[model samples]
Target: MAISGPSPFLRYGVRIANEAHTSLDEAAETLGLLGYAVVDSGLDADQLEALRARFNAIHAANHASTDVERLRAIGEVDLLRCPLADDPLFLALASNPRILELCERLMGAGFILNQQNGIVNPAGAKTYSQSAYHRDLPYQHFVSTRPLAINALFCLDPFTLDNGATFVIPASHKQEAFPSDPVIAAQAKQIAAPAGSFLVLDCMVYHCGGTNRSAADRRAVNHVYTIAMMRQQIDLPAYLGDDFSTDPKIRQLLGFNHPTARSVEEFISQRKAK
Candidate 1:
């Protein structure tokens, strides 16, 4: 049978449009329409190398010995908990004005860093758990009128097809429901971009890691930002403590501004005290 609509991935020119885009508004608009957009992170080769070294140091400290161990402790290897504490670069990149701007456009003024993790897909690492096609906010059953979360992937190494570049379903974020059929789920396109590329994506988009078939490792830093009203995936405030709470922008993004009232009465009382 003849195809009805153009392939979702094809419609976006995702595979072909591998050039770096620098405009924040253009990137935001592309993401709004296609569920994701890849743009230059403005990091040069030296910066990329430094970031990679920092990530490796943190990963080594965690003692991810084997592929099985790394896979088993993906959260640990990925530095899921308090990654900002692991490296200062994490804080700088996650809070970059360009990144914050896109997030603010999607999630309003106050956006919380829901999660930041290191993604290292090494070759011959069998039994890939991250390869499962899924959404970041998997537990949420309902859709929000506005995007509840924005995810940015900071590429530490070039994301090539063979090294398991991320696979995403274009326009899937707009769907009120998840794809049920296996065939429908298989249509996701792999996003290939060079090192120093930052991919911004809607949290609701259907996406997943592809298997690492190449000899080299595929590395990226994943940062997820959510509406400030929602609780962060990790208690960034507790980990960061009161010291880094001085900056207004960082404080707000870290959810320090979120009220700690026990109830409506207490909330009012606390507000009155302020």
Candidate 2:
């Protein structure tokens, strides 16, 4: 007997149809296999422009604020936390139908937006907090049959090699602890994508921002979606207040319905209300 082609044992692993067409299909297949995927964001020129403008305004405002300066002192530079609170545009991006669909596929229904952050890798910075490899669900050390959380990072600028595209360790989400330094160097992959693309990752995957050797800054908005049981990075409902969105789906995504009860009476009231 002669085995001329690839090993049949390859069939033992996760397999999808060769004809898997559509961005969602590709994203699902790759996320299942490599712990990450990139798909077009489908934002037209005008939308992109508006998002960029709003992001810049927020960045300027935050940069001068005392809170942001405090954060910068600790090496967390150009990181905009909860941008959705400042502008509705970020919320719209976070609730993109395709992104939500992908999150539903991986995390099942009732997933909530754990965090939304606008990150900038400044030009010629020595290092930033995100330069260190860490999971979105930091400090956790366990693998799940399915993803507990996922990150959809919308690239606002071309993610070129010189501009500091994100670096990811392929299939690292399956491991409980970070691999050794040598293993990381061998397996690390830099993800270079266009401006209107979303880099989706399993939150368990170890990843970090690359250095921006270019003269321009690299900008992105990151949204982390997790199962409803997990606490949000910020109490989004409280932060955004009641006027943010009237749509139930949008409200739920912002964790309006998942707030913790402060007392036994409140718990009973919530259950009754439900």
Candidate 3:
């Protein structure tokens, strides 16, 4: 008799159910095993509506100035560093207690906010920028027992198979080797969550956005969180400077006042004190 591997489909379903029921610890365990987790109805109705509206307004304003040729080629627009950055609602959503707890489970405390970008995938786009299966972080030869980074994709609109829902290769994060095209194609699973759902993923997972073939734009925002020891994709502290809120959680998420020695002398002093 031989032992068999877990079924990706069944495993993911169980994980999603776990997250939906607020069994965060179980969901985190599943995420560690499968590389992804889906939390249904993570946001309230009013919160979802507000996020959608704010995203729409900002997208329309910025897209008006975008080069048509670039838009045509890309078929998508990512509003990098969302204008609603200052909005406590967006900040709260990004660092939602549940999400933070899940992240902390894998990455430990002092997770830094790495990115927040609103994505709009228009229908019938000739070339979807993120259609290729790839990892979020730059390729490295090594892997970590603990996750270095994680993502939270908040769905502002229905994520349908035909509307650019994300595709992921289950358990790919555990593999130290880069996935070949054939491997990715064979194992990829397209995920469709309802509006207001939150999809969390390990950053090392092989994943991609599906092509949009629907009539309307598929909207979502991505919030990336990483271990505080990792370098931020964007210099958030520099950008925000003194303008950001004084909220402790917000400050922590933004990587402000993270415990660190500024120099060798400081490190020596702190060590002596300890």
TM-score for all predictions? Answer: 0.83, 0.91, 0.81
- Kindly report the root-mean-square deviation of model 3 from the true structure over all alpha carbons: 6.3
Query: Model 2, residue 215: displacement in angstroms?
Result: 0.3
lDDT of 1 by residue, 1-274 (tens): 1123444444543555432244776777778778898867777788889988888887776665446465466444444445577788888888877888888887888678888888778776653556777788885656666789998988888888888888898878888677767745576789998899887888889888888888877788898899877777777777778787598878887787875677899899878887
Estimate, for each residue in 122-216, the C-alpha lDDT of model 2 and write its tens digit. 89986766888999999999999999999999999989888889999999999998999999989999999999789999999999999999898
lDDT scores of the candidates, listed in order: 0.77, 0.89, 0.77
What order do candidates take by TM-score, descending?
A: 2, 1, 3
The alpha-carbon deviation from the true structure for residue 108 of candidate 1, after best TM-score superposition, in angstroms, is 1.4
Per-residue error for 251 in candidate 1, Å, reads: 1.1
Candidate whose lDDT is highest: 2
Give the alpha carbon lDDT tens digit for every residue of 1-274 in model 3: 1123543444433434323333676568778888888866467788889877877777777678788568656654554354435456676677777888888878888788888877777687744667777788867645779789898888889889989899999988887888787987798899898898788898888888888998888888888899888777667777777558688778888877554677999888868875
Clashing pairs in 3: none
Better of 2 and 3 by TM-score: 2
- Candidate 3 lDDT at 50 equals 89
